[model samples]
Target chain A: MTIGIVGAGALGLYYGALLQRAGHEVRFLLRRDFDAITRNGLRVTSPNGDFHLARVLGFRETHHMGQVDLVLVGLKTFANHHLPELVAPLLGPETRILTLQNGLGNEELLAANFDAARVLGGIAFLCSNRGEPGVVHHLDQGRIRLGEFTGGLSAYADSLAATFRQAGIPCEAVADLPKARWEKLVWNIPFNGLCALTGLTTDRLLALPATRDQVRAIMEEVITAANAQELSAPITTEFAARMITLTTAMGAYRPSMMIDRAEGRPLELEAIYALPLARAAEHGVAMTRVAMLHALLEAGEA
Target chain B: MTIGIVGAGALGLYYGALLQRAGHEVRFLLRRDFDAITRNGLRVTSPNGDFHLARVLGFRETHHMGQVDLVLVGLKTFANHHLPELVAPLLGPETRILTLQNGLGNEELLAANFDAARVLGGIAFLCSNRGEPGVVHHLDQGRIRLGEFTGGLSAYADSLAATFRQAGIPCEAVADLPKARWEKLVWNIPFNGLCALTGLTTDRLLALPATRDQVRAIMEEVITAANAQELSAPITTEFAARMITLTTAMGAYRPSMMIDRAEGRPLELEAIYALPLARAAEHGVAMTRVAMLHALLEAGEA
Candidate 1:
């Protein structure tokens, strides 16, 4: 199956290279010249040595991205405001688009921009960072879960999973995708928000017992809000704690939000932190920690 | 009467100039070549134009400041750790040392280093900043409150107030120093800590509604802690609100603690913030906002 990847970031590159290695035609709608790929092709440097894959097609815009079987949107949450312009050129008659972005409100965004039936709810568990234009540093936890939205399981997802598995990338087709999305959110909102606001890495933040407790409290608030919205996943309170422990175990890894802050860019504070608190408040759940943390971040902004 | 002015920062220079302008023999125990004084003497540019006072007797070491009548320690709180060395040359049978530093532990530290009878608690109402070394820009509110440790009044206190009044600096000699100290603490401990940790100026921080409420809650906690310690001031809850209003009324200014942080120097976190919370906990008073603010500051440190 041919695949078109939107937003040639670390995630897009990781998936693009893996699928292309599995003998699928993969193309990237890149923002800039991924010269490293144009020169030496894409490189995936992971804990399991380096995997050099060649001849991954790259496009500077969506206009050049021809018809494909699938499109994956991997842009940052703030960059998703222009989704219509990016997703329009890649949507063929039955071309499915899978969104694996962070924060809430992203799937609704994709659904609003594309046909709901042709959009898949997916979440990527890979920890990757853009080392350079065409170089991606892959860390632990590389898995992708994709499923259909309210429709029966389709052969497109199955073929994509098979292609990914053949290329040594873990892939799965879950029957329920919203739960997976919310489960990923439970970990993202709090830890990312706190790390970004405090400008500390995960281990450095958790090393301070007070901030560690704060991280735990924020996760509980997210969980409460998710449960109140009647959206939860297989991730229990125990699983959330273990996820935090995993990041703490990683040691010295800076959250992406911190990277944005260090680069003097506006953060995803509204989407990742404040919106969940607003959702919790809508359900009349007392989320004072969320409220106070929001206020602290606001104060820092001032 | 001969006087020694230690710490030669903005507060010390302003008060030293005022005392010298009032016909008191003032000697500043500062380094020999402080920039502003060395180049242009001490220039205090205020509402009444500039007063270039060149009467300050500057010394590089405490040994040159032989047996003075009053020793005014106007150093920053972090500089108070070396009080024994700074106070050595000014100690005499009749010398009274005044401390105009912020935070709670300074008085105790001074008492531990010197005789309590010679230590007078002082709170300066002046808003001054160092435009350059030895040059103090006095904005407004140049009032000073002086009170002795003992219940009995002293002639030296009255003499000091008379000198200040003659030099156009407002001052009052209050009988209850502890009350005045606690009242100042109610404002300083919270607002200063918040500004230092968040890097927000006074006007900007109090401009936000949530931050304003946080400041009010912190003041309430500090006052409650003071009452628990049996050192409550005459200021009521309404008066504390009035104090916050007054702080915002005073222009945009970052406290010394903030200046320290901007300069990448070690903060007075223990004295200004942490010790007060520890005292509140020891006194069995609930300091929710104070504790939260301290936690946020500690998180920022990490």
Candidate 2:
């Protein structure tokens, strides 16, 4: 299937590179690395094995990329304003928009601008970063859980998941999208916010008994809010412990928000914190810690 | 009345200077400002009126400062471990131990070491900072409410208030020390922690809508916790708004915790956050935001 990648940062570059290597035509709407990638092609360094693509389709403008079967969005949520214009030119009527962005509201944003029926949301448990120019570093997990924005399982999402699997990603289609999203938040809400606020990594945050307890408390808060959202299954309090255990192995992992804060970039607070908080409040659960965390993060922004 | 000023930072220096200027014998147990104060006396810069006390009584060791009528403990709560040793030599049998430090557990710490009945906790609303060793900058608000640790008004506490008033400090004696402390915390728990964590001043913190709302929420949480402790009367919710308005007039004021965090000094988390949280929990109320704030502050500490 032909694919177009928008907001091509590390996720777009790495995943796009993988698809291209698997014999699919992949095009990237590039910004920062456009020139270098156009001149030098794309280089990917991965634990799976390092490979360099000598001939790559890298575009400075999305309009130049024309239409494709699928459009993958990897834009930072803070830059969501640019999504409509950037993703517009890459859409074919059959194109399914899949946003693998962190936090909530990505699919809704895409669905509102494009076709609500065609937008799919996916949670990528991927650890990757852009190195220099034209180089993408894939450090760890590359699994994708695809689901329909309107809820429930769909054949197209399943096929897309299979397509991701064919490109060497551990991909699966989830029946309950909100549950998957909230389950992901069971980890993101605590680790991302705390890490960004304190400049501590996952392991170090867990290493200190104080913050470690905070991490646990925040996780509990998130799960309580998540369970209130009427998901297919209640995210048990036990899920928090599982997330903590999973993150313990990611030793000193600096979350993306931490890097954003240190580099003076605006945090993705709106999508990651505010929206989730509002949604949870709709379900009659208030997350005080998350709100305080969001406020602290927002107040510190320039 | 002879008074021994222990932990003579800004609070100690300014109040000690005032008491001495009022013709009370004031001896300061000094550290950072020992040399300058001893060599050139003490300089107080204040909106109330600027004054310089020449030939001030300064001591390098507490032993040199003989027993006095009152022992004013103005040390940072983080430095409370040294209070017993520091105040030991300066104690007279009838000397009232009055601590004007921020946060909870301070009065208890002193009461345990010295005479329990003679221990008093005073909430100083003074805004002062130590400058250039011997200088104390008293910016605004020097009102203090003195109360006994064992609770309720006392004849001795009433007299201390009158003495402080004679020294030109706005002072009052309170019937409920715990209630007064918690009311002070209704402001401190939010402003101090938020300002210190974000490196923003009180005005800057309230300038943002998000943080301002957070300030209100935290104040409510504190008040809720405060009310559960069986205060003489519940702190009305309107108190949070009044505190906000009062803070607004003080434009760009930096709480002491913010300054301490900026200077890489340890925060008074144990007294300000942990102790209040634990105390509140004993009454079956929990403060998630305060705990999270405490954990974030603690984890970031070296």
Highest TM-score: give the candidate number.
2
Q: In candidate 1, what are the lDDT values of residues A1-302, reduced to their tens digit? A: 88888877778888788778778889887765466677678888889678887676877788788888888888777787787798888878989888877766767777777777788867787777788666888877778888776544678778767767887888887766766766777777766666776677778777888677777776776777777765434347886788787887777877777777777766666666666666778888866566665666677664
Model 1, C-alpha of B31: deviation from truth (Å): 3.3
Q: Candidate 2 on A267-295: residue-level lDDT in tens?
A: 98988899999999998998878888888
* DockQ leader: 2
Give me the overall lDDT of model 2. 0.89
Per-candidate TM-scores read 0.86, 0.95
lDDT of 2 by residue, B158-204 (tens): 98999999999889999999999999999999988888888889988
| Native contacts recovered, each model | 0.41, 0.86
Query: Deviation in angstroms for B277 in model 2?
Result: 1.4
- In Å, residue B227's CA in model 1 sits off its true spot by 5.6
